[model samples]
Target chain A: MSNPFQIPEQEQHELDQLGAELRDAMPEVSLSEDFHEHLAAKIENSWSIRSAFQNNRMIRMAAGLLVMTLAAAPVAAWVGIWPQQKKNPPAIGFEIPEEVNVDESGGALGDSEDNQVTGPNDEFEAVEWSPQRRVALERYNRLVTAVASYELHGQDMELARFEGFSDQSAWASASEESLWLEFARRCAQADLSPLSAELVARCTLMLAAPLDRNASKQQRAAYAAWAWLLEGEQAKAADLQMNWPSAPFLTQN
Target chain B: MSPSSDDLLTRFAAGDPAAFDELVASLGPRLKGYFLRQGAQSSTAEDLVQNVFVRLLQNASRYQASGRLDAFCLRIARNLWIDHRRRGGRVFSSEEAFDRADPRPGPVQEADSGDRAVHLRSALDHLDADTRELLELAVLQQLPYREVSVILEIPVGTVKSRVYYSLRKLREQLHNLGPQEDLS
Candidate 1:
């Protein structure tokens, strides 16, 4: 393999120039003047309540540290009690993760006073995700694990085309026009009487999305191998895995 | 993906209203634009920007920034996007019908003038999700290749070459659309 980084000087110069043009061509996104003021006001009004339910422990930890400091101050000043001068701005005392305040609508939830808290964890229970989303995530993880661990699932291709497919839709849209679709069609109709028997049924419901009807040959084989693994037949999956073409699935791309 | 001054973030964490305004002014729009480029809707992009501000309000970006504040912020935006994907994924609920047009009303909405930027955007939409993201970070976000490499967790060389190929592909798509524009 030739060295990728060692571009000739002429090409490197062209690339550098191209880079500047690309930057200039891509116009910058400018916000309205009021946007900053409005967002600042909104954060000031709502995020404290948003933070209270975000995480209970961080506040408790901060409070505990404060109490420890107060107690130690008296001990150190026992001989001559003195008051400590306050800093210009009081410490906020807690840090929040970037996503802590957001809900699906992309805003803080619970506008009513109920979201307000005198102390962290004092008011409402801060459930980040509801029960339904939690279960869906869990099932998705299981399917990813099953598919990813399959010996035959070694290709580096991505099936990210299905941006908006759900289990129900996948099942509804299943057709026998192609092998992967046929696999999905069968899986969609899966009966759950036995765990092994339901492997096909779980295929669409569990994975991000089933293979498309027009998926490449390797895509179909990849799905078939996952079905085999989901049914506990690793050897069969491995055998089928060998026939995959140069590319693989499950990469970020 | 916006440039946030670590110093301003530190002041904001300490509850300075001026710093808060400055940070929001500087970071909010660009961050929202980044989200929009990554395929989020207008409302969703606004929400994503607000969420980043909320996190910044809680502490100094200084805590995370080792001199590369933009990288630090972009990493947060990326994680929020991943979380949004999982929560809003198709399993438990259905997505709004996927619209081919961006809903934000601005220079991007000019559908009739044969705007070159519009053509560029349409061409960009033709690429796959990952490739689009790579180009968005490396080019649109204006982050250095090394910074983008760290955020995307890929080699700097690979990032540069991929950006080259992606732009080449995008340029071909653009040429197919019309004749006046040249990304070369």
Candidate 2:
């Protein structure tokens, strides 16, 4: 390959073997182990960057959607149709089957001072400090109120029965002194029956498991390599591919 | 190049993260090594490679796949390298970045891939940046003259002549490094 500058730059020899020798001598290089971690972060950012380039297209498409939405707004408003944003919490309500008898016997043996749910420092306030636990307690309290109102008797009450609700194992595995378990015990010790309180606790404690709707047990990890990033809203948010699947439901918000 | 490597662009364009992953895993070393071959430090090479992927993703929809995945990546990598130089590549401090960027013993020295190629690496390091880049494009990547022309943004004739000169320079440098068994 060196015939060009040979004459112009004094005496020189052609050594085409250098390419093959370099190939033979240099081993194929390996990437750093954190290459994928860096790549994933870049890909996520690229999704946002790709969108910026098509902001014109997005604006046009959004305008078209807005016109159609405006046309249907009056009829939709009269009929009481409301589109829920993905970030909004689900609008779920269930009728409670039985009434809370509320053990008002002035201080039954089961209603010991230590048995009630309370903040870490305040034993009197029946409120939980953790937002997640508060959600559980709120749901539990709302169900008790619904049962007492006796107003709604026979709605689809699926939650009342908690049929097909997984996470029984999670609830069962909790230590006896778990705060939720103690709260459930308090309910059971109240004039409320064992079965109903157990059902309520089982239905609610599932939310605290730190599981994503899309996650599964690893079973085993490939210490050598990482799996691909899941597709959908993540892939689509990039605005590059249209065939990615829609994200499955239940983002906790 | 196997069809599997060729399809990194195709699969990535279709939004396959695994394909994107495979593309990075396959092409990342080439890019980082290219920067290193051109005398970039470990952190700079890593940052350049990262920019290449981000650029590829940004242009995935518009980039016409020409059945050359390495060329596609190298094109971005070369451009980023230019930009990186213009910005006056930041001085890297802290050997910590060095230890992290390379798991092997000191840069590419202890790459378990075997064979230090110490003389050749040292010889390549001695070459000027432009000479090393020309060698990287023509000799190392072995890209066709036309692809090399486009990536370097030079005429094919210029590529041919410069690569010849670069080869002569590298051959001379290796000669000066003296009778290393590997090269001899």
Against the true structure, what is every candidate's RMSD?
39.4, 29.1
Candidate 1 residue lDDT tens string, A62-135: 87799999998888886354322221211222222232232234333122224322324536555455432332
Candidate 2: clashing pairs of residues: none
- In Å, residue B145's CA in model 1 sits off its true spot by 2.6
* Per-residue accuracy of model 2 over A1-253 as CA lDDT, tens digit each: 7755345433223345676666555545567678678767776766663356453577767777989999888978766644322223222232222342322333332112343445545545554233323333344443243233222222223223322214544445443224222332222222222233443344334333433434432111110001101111222122221111121121222
Q: Rate residue A44 of model 1 by lDDT.
A: 76
Provide the lowest-lDDT 10-residue window in model 2 chain A. A219-228
What lDDT does the true structure give each of the candidates? 0.54, 0.53
C-alpha lDDT (0 to 100) for residue A204 of candidate 2: 32
In model 1, pairs of residues that clash are A155-A248, A155-A249, A156-A248, A157-A248, A187-A200
